[model samples]
Target: MSEPTTGPAGAAFDDFVAARSTALWRSAFLLTGDRHKAEDLLQAALVKTWRRWDRIGHGSSRSHETAEAYVRRALATTYTDWWRRRWRGELPTGELPERAGDVDEAARAEVRHDVLTALAALPRGQRAVLVLRYFDDLTEQQTADALGVSVGTVKSQASRAMTALRSSPALTDRFGDAA
Candidate 1:
């Protein structure tokens, strides 16, 4: 991803960043299962969205200046493109040594890690569907629009992704045992 250059339209971009970057980064971590990778993903998505802010933020109605939709769309597109091209293996979400000091911190970290690993194991398109539908609490049509796919695709992706997760050993051990 390229660096963010300066421009007059940057105010809207800046507003978006100030409002949403942290939550987006958190969602990114869940989607990516890596803090560093999530940061990179957030920066890349932000840059891409900022580049198009003018057209998106043009003097139009509220629906036209949809920053959330734009960012989500950029993230889904970037992630799907990268996964298609690279097909990277799942990132391990096992607790890192960095979490050793505090018990409460470690437990929270562990849970986040397991969930992320479980989620990231899905195909990128499916993972995007999951993140948008569940993590972002978006509707099927919202996810479909964000991913540039169809509502049927979103449904199938979520169903397939959930089936895969339920059968996954990590998820079974971490969450299924409670069922």
Candidate 2:
């Protein structure tokens, strides 16, 4: 699709992306647990949001807020859609392809991997809830709005996700005595 690059709509869209893409990318990475998948997810959500930009941009004085919410909601729904379709084009292996050069970096990478592995084990709804509520620092109401779920669902999912994370072997194996 052709994007508007010269008009007010184009400027606003570009500005929004520039301002928020990094934060949005972090949310996407937390959601997907993989860098490439997160990039794909963010791109797809942005494209979807861009398609509706005219309507989103023209209707309100709070157009920026509206556009942000729309983009966030799009990201959440698109992720859910992709999960439901079960698109598993890549498989996890038992070993890292390359070792970290430094011991400190290796330790950090291991911790990050374990955390990601634990997060990846969660059901999509719970994972999404945790990512939105904790990782993205969104409120329960905001998370619910983004996920198209009720506030209660968000709370319950967050509770369950935390419980699951606490018990996940990927985490407990590394930090068993600390908890």
Candidate 3:
């Protein structure tokens, strides 16, 4: 009997991570809208992907794509689960929280922040759709697969998300007539 080979698979996993980690992290950050949360989200997704790496990495022509799809799916599902769980424990308070730090109006980063803020205001599924579709450039079917939803769901979410962003005063100001 032949022993199972771990060396090539491990190397392939490593290569996949090295090539795709940054892009995946960026998607996680867009989904989370917070750097700390993004890091945690990405780490969780990576751990889940690593656990299933061998199975995902051994396919035919689509092995690399399969691995990426698995990781992306993990990120989307984990973020949705985390958001639900986090909100479940929050106590509703009548008092308004402290304001965030003042932003410099002249800085482009502030405008970018405004766009992100608008993005964060979206529902979790819509936000995931935007990230998977626009940020990661996944096709509608791919986005649907990643989120474990039907293609119709992906279309509706993307449409609603775009409408929300376009109507958002913050984003409208950032993009002006372009929005």
Candidate 1, residues 1-179: lDDT per residue as tens digits?
A: 33345664565567667878988997787777777978988889887776767666633346233877888888778876767788556644443665546899877767766776677677877888888999999999999999888999999999999888888777788778551
lDDT of 3: 0.84
Encode model 2's per-residue lDDT on 66-178: one tens digit a residue: 87788788888899898889856787766534464777777888888899899999998999999989988889999999999999999999999999999999998999946
Per-candidate total of colliding backbone pairs: 0, 0, 0
Off by over 4 Å in 1: 1-8, 58-65, 87-95, 98-101, 177-179
Ranking by lDDT: 2, 3, 1
In angstroms, the error of model 3 at 70 is 0.3
- In candidate 3, position 159 carries an lDDT of 98
Lowest lDDT block of 10, candidate 3? 90-99
- Per-candidate Cα lDDT values, in order, are 0.76, 0.86, 0.84
Per-residue lDDT of 1-179 in model 3, one digit per residue for the tens?
A: 23224687777777777888899999999998877789999899988887877667553548878988999999999999998888545543232233356345336566667888799789999999999999999999999999999999999999999999999988888678678
Give each model a TM-score: 0.82, 0.88, 0.83
Pairs in clash, predicted candidate 1: none
Model 1, C-alpha of 127: deviation from truth (Å): 1.0
Evaluated against the true structure, the overall lDDT of model 1 is 0.76
